[model samples]
Target chain A: MTLGLLVEEAGLFSTVQDLGRQGFQSLGVPPSGALDPVALRLANLVVGNPPGCAGLEMCRLGATLRVTVPSLRVALAGAPPTGDLPVLRSLTLREGEVLRIGRVAGGAAYLAVEGGFDLKPVLGSLSTYARALIGGFEGRRLEPGDVLPLLRHTASSRRERALPHPLPAERDRPLRVVLGPQADHFTEEAFDALLGEGFTVTAEADRIGLRLSGPRLAHAGPPEIASDGNATGAVQVPGSGQPIVLLPDRHTVGGYPKIATVITADLARLGQSLPGTVLRFEAVAPEQARIALRRQEAEIAALAARLHET
Target chain B: MCAQPAAPPALLHDPPRLLLLGDAALTVEFAAAWSPEAAARVRRLAARVAVLAAAEEGIREYVPTLRSVTIHVDPSRLSLRRLQAMLRDLPEGAEATAGEATEWCLPVRYGGEQGPDLPEIASTLGMAEDEVAELHTAGHYEAAAVGGYPGFAYLTGVDGRLALPRRASPRLSVPEGSVAVANGFTGVYPATAPGGWHLLGRTPVPLFAPDRPGRPALVMPGDTVRFRAISPEEFEGLWSAFRDGRADPVTACRAP
Candidate 1:
């Protein structure tokens, strides 16, 4: 039997997101997806779906889900929607049921699919960040009483399957960054100052970017740079005298001075950090960053492969 | 036939180059300076590149920004070096022919509660509020891009007279459909969110609605926009009509 959960009491910022919708940024759309890719992958893994399967990314306050399927294996990760602490709660969902999650303690939660959620993949992806208004539930956040039509799967689930172990959450620290092609845009001391100091993640943070409140880093001169392409980790410093770390939903180009970019491997870590979670920056070379990312990707692939086999 | 490594390197005019940003992405650089010619080239290259990347697996996503295109591929099925090789085979430095775009006459209600900063903006420009509204609606603007926020179209070609700096402190929430101007540009807020741009008026027309047939974002890149001033009474009538599902926006526009 195959079925999907009906969303009841959709929490603060719940949306159906996947790895991210790519290839549309050039059209001026940001790739809004799961903030914590690893957790999203694991959640999908637990449900015996592909790592890139579409799932719900519940932020701050989690929502209540009524399982419409007779039997389904569901796993919880990240800060449980609301007041639901200690991510990694696994349970067998009964047909015509309700699961209420509390305010997330750390970041966001990932709910995976068994054979992958049977949602229409727009441009080959299913993560809904709602900023671009493209993927998941018609390019908007999940709402109360929304019916999620599940994708049917041939693989039968073995009852009482052991829940996957929890991943060690990296918290409240300086995020590591790699030096950029434009590191010369800032003074030597300013570049160095980024690594040594602590920055408070401001309340102004969102899927588009995370603004930091800290000591002003001095630029070489008047900081009006030409608009250029940006990536997820790029740390852009605009005229406001504050540094903002671009995220998945960030704009494709900007005129701000990008001091550094967080490594791809550490991006998932930065995503899950709660607002007010103090973060610092550590500079790394591009090669080192790539190697680190490759290792993480390999681990994720292995986990995905194992879960899918079951 | 695949071009050989023996092929002589083309002299870098605008220096068509591909840079590996991370493990899963690469950026095709167009130009260092911002110009129409460069922007046109970017649009062309981005369109072509998107076509090429569309069928290519392992290449998860590709987005075209203002001046560059970002390609996001799966590292497991593809590698940074291999993706670079594929791009090298692509024709670079290609020119683009400009195309005609759709035009819209966005109706807005200026001043009073709808536009909170209309008086302040008018005071700053040494003009009456009505004069400012008149100037804003007179210009036919180009939709440079549909980013910054979803369904938010950054319109260009606003007259310099109406240009003003962004507010020192952005309001916590600028009402949806608020027509705003900052730094010589004007855009309408599709949804309510924090904003710094100076408000001029509000439109009842929905710029972004997920439930709509188009699924949010009424305007796309390469579209044209013209604002029309309306009275508060007219605004209320239109607002209620749309709210009650009586208004059907005439979208007689498309990318040409």
Candidate 2:
């Protein structure tokens, strides 16, 4: 039987996202995906879906969805609701029940449903790239009156559950980075300026990237490099001296000189950082970055194992 | 001059310099200069890398640009050092084979509402609007790289005389399929996007159609592009045919 949900009131911005659209960078396709992948995986797992299942990623004020199916199971992660509602826990809604998500405490949140979204993967992913007008539901942000198809699910005994481990709390620690493919392009003073001072996330931040306002970094030589591939969390400094932390929706290639790359483990924290939040950068060894990433992965696996045990 | 013989591959005299683009990707740059020889060398290296990627585990994808190839990898499955070592072992100056690239003839409607900057561009270059269009149509351009926007090909090989710098203030939105020129390169905007390039014309054919099967982009890196001017009436006719699925924006041509 077919199942679905109707968006009652679309909030600030909501789009369906999965792990990413992979293997298409050569064609200049951006890997548009969930900004907070950890939260997305967790939310999906809570709903008994695979980690890469497509889910709704909401920013700021979240959307209100009405269950059109006989019943629907869902889980929320990342930003908690400002209201008394408990999140990061699995919950079920009856037919005609409305799920209201309030303004995000942080920057974004992920809502995953049981059996995942019933959508065809574009270029092997359901992630939405609004700029290119591809992927997701109708290749655009969710709005009122939009109906989303849901993968049919069989009723299960375990309808509700809570995460064994609490979601990671937002910390004020410095964002760790691994210094560069183009570190030599800048003077030592530039490095000092980059790491020594603080940067405020500008209002221009979005799924594409975060523009930071901080002390201007001085280039020792020409600022332009032969255009090269850009990575998620690549800290690129253009001629303006302001750094841009690229995200999932960033262009595949860029000409700006990248001074550092934020470690994989810290990307979730970066994703949660709201505009006006001050951030500091800390340089770490490549080995340290890898170890941190492995640790996070291990934690995720452990969480999944724990959930299965329950 | 609309169709020229494919450039002979240049022998890689100097070893490519490799730089780590974070832990997940590495860039192999052949030369800093933008020249046919440099582009040829980069393409050859990219081909070699593609073979390695297919044979080896952990390599995700590779993007070939004007003078370099960037290979993305899974760090957990493959170490940066090991991947670098594998690349170092590849044979240097491998003779590149010929007749592998495809040539595409794209139809464009010049001047009028489609291209508002045509007169300004022509006057600035001391040439008539038709002369500007003719010069643009004459050059056989190569797809240097496809980026900046989805399916937007950074084409090279615009005639030196028709080369123009980007506008001081970029247009808020350039219409999709607008044929533009800037800094010795000619390209077609795959979608409506903000751009600074001087628009000379617009093509009814979509450069990028995600809905199309097989290849979503009409042109990829290393493909040759030739523009043929069409009358406004013909433009409308071809556009309708394309919309109705009777005509394709791209057709295959054997490399000469």
Candidate 3:
């Protein structure tokens, strides 16, 4: 079948999400989307769903979803369930049987189907802001006993296919970043210290931003600058001398000086990492990062194509 | 596309400086600090950009922060280059809306246990506690911005005479509805959040609510608010009425 099943038990933090609400940043709203884009695309492809269709984003400890109707294609991708578990895991759920995701292998997972999940749009977005309590399912985290209705789909074609295979979980990949436009705001010593040293993800991390614990990266210039726009991977060195890496739900702007920003290609991996994940940053040229991003996109597209063929 | 475009660069520097944020986002910033003029200008620009992005569906989401805007896009369909191009042709700025804007009359119970820092703030600003309370409630303040924790309305027009710095070390948690001021801005913490601001009093009003209609924020940008000091009995009665949903915020503030 096309549309999979409704979620009977939504794990840690689960909600329907797409690429997030974009143009509204000017409204003081952060664009919330799937944490792992690569996995999200793959899941959509595996289920024969449109690549842009909204999918379920599951955070640490996935939920137990029960497949209703008949059989359906589904794929799960995110950080490997702890211990280098494969990113993509395949499991079947009977009409009444519950599929449970134990503890989080990674912080997030993507549940995709042959047909996209049907959800009403809020401000033209299916993504949830939990804080604003808008978008997604009533704009809040999926709780136990929440009955979600699925977007109906057609029967599957006459074809047999092997379940999706998991990708190698790079739980320990070095975070690749590009020097920020404000890199000059930090001292050469602080900049060097940032790249040369390592940081551990603190427990105080969330979709808003990742707080890191390591050598404080002090601002070499004025501690305060006019508030400027920043993105998810912006490495903002706040007044505490500690760097806070902004994330999807980060504020629209900040006054802290940023030393560098993690290249966009690596943000998903960073977002999926659990607390205490040791991270190191390796600078990449902007051109190189762009090329790498294109390649990554192509790979995701290919993976989706493979699933459709089956 | 690699070469920088030649133009006057509008009000900002050359090419309207853009920084690649991560794999999926980019930030177009104006300057370093938060100036009211810059904040206003940025807000206007952000509103226009948001409208354009929504109309085109080329971008995902864009949020307006204090001084800049963050646009979240689907890298697959819209690349940084394309977004940059879209930014170049953006409609410039947001037109200031007319109408005096709705004014909110917030009722608060001042002094004693409710406001621990009231005396300290009064001393710091060299004004009597009653005088401080009088000055605070006398004028209407324009909401300058709404950031730094959800529902935290940063208001303008604090009695400049009562301005004081925030505590060196903030308390772990100030109860929700605590009215506080620091660094030339006065606000009521919508929720229980750690803050170094000077406490003035407590308002039982819900500043931030998720279930309410119309964006879920009590006081949004561009609203004017005036504080009214009330008795503890009034505070308790209003708190009960609000919690029970029997009273509307507008009605509560309007009542004597």
Candidate 4:
């Protein structure tokens, strides 16, 4: 088989992504990529692909893929939709084999192939930002009957490698944030509400942002600021007072005053949080946040280390 | 690509403040309001940062806006602490490249179906249609920021008299190349999308083209932009020229 999988069913909000499209935000292109980047990395490593290889990012619902390539190494990570496709385990799917990935337990899941996709990079990225219809598998999500170009075929080996799930135990902890590039624009009461309250993720969540319904974050004035570069995970409190945690697909520049920004270490944890899930925020110093990020990186590196033992 | 240290640049009254935006990004904030002074600093900082990011592999990307520039880096390659220290040491006299900008004079056909809200805009401001167009052409605009969509530059420096608020209800589809004004800014909707601005006209030239050879954004932030009113014939000719790939808009519109 020349191509990878023949999609029998296209899941809700499924797209081909890598880390993200980079160095293009100045041109107003939002960097769209895998919601759970850590999962994509782990899935890639387990499948013997580069940690930042392109893979399918499925949210909530998962697609049913029929293997088209003669033989390819595959693995699912980050809240695998179905028990059949266990998290962090690699499997070799041959031609005519059907893999049914059902519903995700959390916000999103990733399915990685050994050599990644044969799709071209746009502006130096394999990530798909469908709004502009740029990059990755025709610059859009996969559809039924769409032939996904698989880059390389792996020799069929019976050795299936796996790693223990690492994020589950820390899932319930509050997501850490670094207080602002615009914290002074918000009121003290706003900070109290943001730190003390548990915000429930609303149905309006997407790769763009997670709309949170929590205590209102009152602004010092009308929620206005000179449009500035928006950092990923910036908790922007607009006139509605609802805090929308900006995600990978967020606009590069924003006019609203940002209250606080979630640390990079907690972004994957935040990504896995599904709608109706209550999440709390904790502000940490940048130094502590760096330490947390380093720890998370260590965890992934260690996971990669255990891959050989499996 | 290094920072030039001739002298401190003008138009900036306060020293830029460096603020952390999580563990990966550090925003260099120039000002809090939308003013020409802040816009100049934003443009100057973007020029320097682009040079620095290219020279240093550690810095990942940087997004420039009207008031700030957010620099992203992999913490492993460049820690936030190192980035902060580097910026603190960067001499702020990079405005030497300020005058080296190309002014794009885009052609637009004003009024009629070409600009549905032009009549309303003129009436709202108590001016005649030609008077409105004249005032619009009289002012200079700079691409202070590019957002909302790819190549959609947030053009600042609209004439104060022509300033108007956006519509309460946005139009479902603002035709591509639609030039509009709202809240003291003039922006051209690069791609047809939901928009709330007051339509002034539609430009024949495109702002964002994927196949653009040199840069992604045609009217990049810090570039100057000027609008020229054209007849229906001129509009039709330029529009088709751009659409059918007869004339390259970038080469045609860029002032020598």
TM-score of each: 0.76, 0.93, 0.78, 0.93
- Model 2 per-residue lDDT tens digits across residues B1-256: 5889865446433667777776777777776656788787678777777778878788988888877888888777776678899888888654335336678888889999998999998888888999989988898999988888888898998898877778899999999989998877889999998999999999888788787786688888888989889999988988788879787665522233
**Model 2 lDDT on a 0 to 1 scale:** 0.84
Ten consecutive residues with minimal summed lDDT in candidate 2 chain A? A152-161
Chain B TM-score for candidate 3: 0.83
For model 1, residues B145-180, the per-residue Cα lDDT tens digits are 666666777777889887777899999999999999
Which whole-number lDDT from 0 to 100 does residue B18 have in model 1? 67
Model 1 over residues A60-173: C-alpha lDDT tens digits?
Answer: 678888888776666666555545333443456677767777666777787765665678876557777575467787778888878777765233556433334545565654
Put down candidate 4 lDDT per residue, A22-100, tens digits, no spaces: 8888889988888889989989878878888999998898988988778888899887675566778888888889888
lDDT for model 3 comes to 0.71
Q: Using lDDT as the measure, name the better of candidate 1 and candidate 4.
A: 4
Write down the C-alpha DockQ for each prediction: 0.25, 0.56, 0.29, 0.68
| Per-residue lDDT over A1-310 for candidate 3, one digit per residue giving the tens place of the 0 to 100 score | 3334656677777888886775444335566777776677666655556766777888787777776656555666665455343344333344555566556667787876556566777656788888667688778888876655566544366453333554445666778888875777888788777888889889888778888989878787786665556677888888788888887777666678878888767877877867888788888876677787787667665654455233
Candidate 4 reference-contact recovery: 0.75
Rounded to one decimal, what is candidate 1's iRMSD?
3.4
Better of 1 and 2 by lDDT: 2
Query: lDDT for model 1, on a 0 to 1 scale?
Result: 0.72
Residue range B49-158, candidate 4, lDDT tens digits:
76677677889898887777889988767888998777767777643354456788888898888888888888888899988988888778888888868899888888
Error of 1 at A2 (Å): 16
